[model samples]
Target: MDLVGKVAYITGGSKGIGYGVAKKLLQAGMKVAISGRTLETVQQAAEKLGKTDKVLAIASDVSKHGDEKKAVAQILAKWGTLDVVLANAGVGHFAPIDEMSDAQWHAMINTNLNGVFHTLKASVEALKKSKGYYISLASLAGTNFFANGAGYNATKFGVVGFTQAAMLDLRQYDIKVSTIMPGSVATHFNDHEPSPEDAWKIQPEDIGDLVLNLLHMNPRTLPSKIEVRPTRPDKK
Candidate 1:
């Protein structure tokens, strides 16, 4: 797809992988509307990017239906059309099932799974018109189980299935859908600060580049599911 002049709506675009993808899209000449739960952070990030005219920042909690509608309405008001939707807003809660609190499990399911649904539902009409793309940020945990990661794994696994099924459902309308599952990205996910030890992990920009590549791929060929990981994991 031609990125120039395209308009994209990215959720959780204030920091981490979403911010990196927004920066890449902006550099590619796409107008983007970035949504986050915090208006201050979203605005600050937009300003830092130095393309305010081409970027719209809106505070939105993807877990809520009303928030998703408001964000989409704002984007349409600004750009008149939406070409891409990246459902990257997610939260993580790591704990054994027996030890996990109700709040922890709910938070993960709401943000990581239901949030994607709201985002896609809010953007579907515009995307159908533009024959656009929908990308979801899953995780390697979606396919691999680990101790104390039950909440996160369940959401990601659901995401992978949701994205793949959505791809099949939307393809007839000429809209593409894909999911990216990456391992150990250098980001502040789950409140973990990135450190030098993260050098072996994938960078946010690498995922950004991957999104670009997926967009540029021929329409005849859709790489529906992507799993990316560090070339060299740290040895204990």
Candidate 2:
């Protein structure tokens, strides 16, 4: 697909993986729209990308269907078409299931699971019109279970399942769907600061490049699920 002039919407794009994807798409000549719950951060991210003309910054809460709907509408209003949708907004809460609060559990479920649902639901019609692509950023936790990961694991697992089923359901319309499961990415997720020691892990731009590769693939071929991790872990 010719990326030039194509439009893409990315949720949680103010930082981390989503921001990296936005930068890559813009560099590929796509008109990119990035959303954050905070207007200031979204604007800052757009400015950082340094493509005011090609970038649209929207303040949107992916957990809310209304916000997603408005965001899609805004993107269509500005670009007149939508070609890609990246449901990348997610949160993680680690606690024993017994000790987890309702807020913690709900936050993960709402943003990680229902958030993807809302973003896709709001954009499906536009995607059908453009025969676009949809990708969700899941996590290694989606498949591998661990202690203190009940909430995060549930949501990521749900994301993987939902995206796979969505792939089947949307393919008839030529709207490709896929989920990327990445391990130990270097980002500010979970409110942790990235340090030089994290360089060995997956970089945000690596995921960006992965998304670019997927977009360029032949429409007849679909890699419905991808699992990626670092080749070399940080030595103890």
Candidate 3:
């Protein structure tokens, strides 16, 4: 697809993978809208991205349907049409099931799972109009469970299932859907700070490259589920 002028929306785009992907899409000549829970942060990112006509910043909480609906409406108002949606907003609260607080579990479910559904619901009609693409940022934990990760695991697993099922349901409309599961990405997720010592982990731009590849893939081919990992996890 020719990316010039094509408009894309990314949730949780203030930093990390979402921000990284926004940079890549803009570089490829696409107009990009990035949203976060805070307006100041998203605006700062948009300013850093430059191309004032091509970058839009929105304040949205993806877990809320109304917020996501308002966000999509703003995107349509600015760009006239939406060509892509990236459900990248997520949170992690790791603890043994017996010890995990109700707040932590619900936070994961509400943001990681319900957030994706809300984002897609708000954007699906616009996608049908453009026959566009929907991509979610899941994690390897979706498939591989580990101790103290039950809540996080359940939400990501739901995301993978949700995206795959949505792909089947949307294909007839020419709307493409896919989920990307990445391992050990270097980002400020769950309050972990990134530094030079984290070079061995997958960088956010690596995931951006994958998104670009998927966007440029043959229209007839649908890579609905992708599992990506660092080439050498043992290096560190």
Candidate 4:
């Protein structure tokens, strides 16, 4: 698809993978809107990305269907069409099933699982009109079960499953759907600070490039699921 002049909406785009994708899309000449839970953070990120008419920052919570509806409405009001929707908003709360609190499990499900549904539901109509793409940022945890990761695992697993089925269902309308499952990315996820020492981890911009590639792929092909990881582990 021609990326120039396309319209895209990215959830939780204030930072991390969402922001990375947003930056790349902007560079490709797309009008992009990024949303975060807080208006301040979203605006700050927009400013950092260089405030311009091509970019929009909105405060939205994907966990709430209403918020996503409003966000998509705002994007359409501004651009008149939506060509891409990236459901990248997520939160992680890891704990053993036996020890996990209700809050932790619910938070994971609400943000990482239900959030994707809300975002997709809100944007599906616009996407149907444009026959656009819908991509979700899942994780390797979706397929790999680990100790002390029950909550996080369940949500990601659901995301992967949901996206795969959505892909099949949406194909009839020519709306491309895919899930990107990245491992060990250097981002502020799970309260980890990224540092130079974390060079072995996959960088956010790497995912950005991957998203761009996906966008430019042949219209006849759909790479519905992708798993990416760092090439090497950190040496002790």
- Clashing residue pairs in all predictions, respectively, total 0, 0, 0, 0
- lDDT per residue (tens digit) for residues 95-213 in model 4: 67899999988998999999999999999999999999999999999999999998899999999999999999999999999999999998998888889987899988889899999
Better of 2 and 3 by TM-score: 2
Query: Model 2 clash pairs?
Result: none
Ten contiguous residues with the weakest lDDT in model 2: 190-199
For model 3, the superposed segments whose C-alpha errors exceed 4 Å read: 234-236
Candidate 1 segments exceeding 4 Å error: none
Q: What is candidate 3's lDDT per residue for 108-214, written digit by digit as tens?
A: 99999999999999999999999999999999999999999999999999999999999999999999999999999999999989998789889999888999999
lDDT, each prediction: 0.93, 0.96, 0.96, 0.93
Candidate 4 residue pairs in backbone clash: none
Q: List the RMSD of every prediction in angstroms.
A: 0.8, 0.6, 0.8, 0.8
Runs in model 4 deviating more than 4 A are none
Model 2 off-target regions past 4 Å? none
Score every model by TM-score.
0.98, 0.99, 0.98, 0.98
- Global CA lDDT computed for model 4: 0.93
- Comparing candidate 3 with candidate 4, which one achieves the higher lDDT? 3
